[model samples]
Target chain A: KDDTKKEIMKYYWTSLHTTLANYPSLPTLHERNTLYHYVISSASLFPCGDCSIVSQKLMRKYPPQIGSRKSALTWGCKIHRKFNEEFNLTVPTCDDIAASYIIGS
Target chain B: KDDTKKEIMKYYWTSLHTTLANYPSLPTLHERNTLYHYVISSASLFPCGDCSIVSQKLMRKYPPQIGSRKSALTWGCKIHRKFNEEFNLTVPTCDDIAASYIIGS
Candidate 1:
């Protein structure tokens, strides 16, 4: 079961990576960081902070570090569970972004 | 007091209008609408659904309709206040997006 979840995170990240690859100038890390902070500062955004929807997508497709591979999955789970407090929406974990959803294109 | 609030909404719309001027290919209403629905399905996103962060930003800058100018202000507030349940974040009314935050970039 966990393996399936991890696989999904992978796909999600992969898709994000593909989308961002087209952009010649990736927003600076600072800009991204600022944006992330802005989104997460709010309770809704913050719960999803540990893992950004975009970051999870980016990492699975193009991991900056090997360690991120697992972090993507793990961190994503944390955010999903956190947000599920009320809405019961399926939380997006890092792995869900990477391999599963990020499937090439 | 209401006038001040309305003025603030006006400024927000203006800022959104400015940012949109740069987008050569604006996302179609359908596409934008899809994305908006995706984000808002959850309670967090929905509260902000009445006023999409990007839409509020877009409308204030480039209006498809004059009627939307006012909708931007009203809807934004509904979403902002809705999310304040656990996270006392300032509600982002439509006006916040159009005239205030949308100030020319």
Candidate 2:
């Protein structure tokens, strides 16, 4: 568990750096890390596309079915990761992590 | 693929909201999702606990061997989530998502 905790911490921080790097403007370490925890542990709200990072794109496709405070409580952050051992699509960074929502199970 | 994409988007955005909930503040879905992609795909740098979301907590314990820009590029985000379908720690939201780094393989 010690090792797992260490590994978990390392993975979480690095993920934040990588997440902010895409914007060409890096977010503060605290900002990124805090946000990281929020999403990971957050509940699955409504659905993914309903509250995606790129919502406009999703809205264009489906507009009528989005938004609900109750659903918000159940949403979890969705970042896709594919490692050499995990998915073999190694690229140092995941393909894309559009901020989307996940409904609770 | 279309359905997968839809699912992915929804999951990402909702995650941000959940993440922000922890701070009693909310980050835009865009902010969270962008960060999500970075951590997901970034290479694992050094090891975890080196650059954790709660770094001060880590620095107190393990000092002297943290931070290496080269390693930075390889680090991935670390968020601990146990889904009912994925793991058994199902709790609407994940356990925690610390901003730690992952040393890429």
- Which candidate has the top score in lDDT? 1
Off by over 4 Å in 2: A26-105, B1-105
Per-prediction DockQ: 0.03, 0.04
Most TM-score-accurate candidate:
1
lDDT value, residue A99 of candidate 1: 43
The alpha-carbon deviation from the true structure for residue A99 of candidate 1, after best TM-score superposition, in angstroms, is 4.4
Q: Model 2 over residues B28-77: C-alpha lDDT tens digits?
A: 56444534433332212111222232333332433311133222212211
RMSD from true fold, candidate 2: 17.3
Tens digits of per-residue lDDT, candidate 1, A9-96, equal 3333332232222212444454344333322322222112223444344434443321232333344345444533333546655555
Clash count per candidate = 65, 68
What does the lDDT read for residue B50 in candidate 1? Answer: 31
Model 1 C-alpha lDDT per residue in residues B1-105, reported as the tens digit of each score? 444333333333232233232222444554344323322322222112333354444434443331232443344344344433224446555555444443232
Identify the runs in model 1 with alpha carbons over 4 angstroms from their true place.
A1-29, A41-74, A81-105, B1-60, B63-70, B73-105
lDDT of 2 at A72: 21
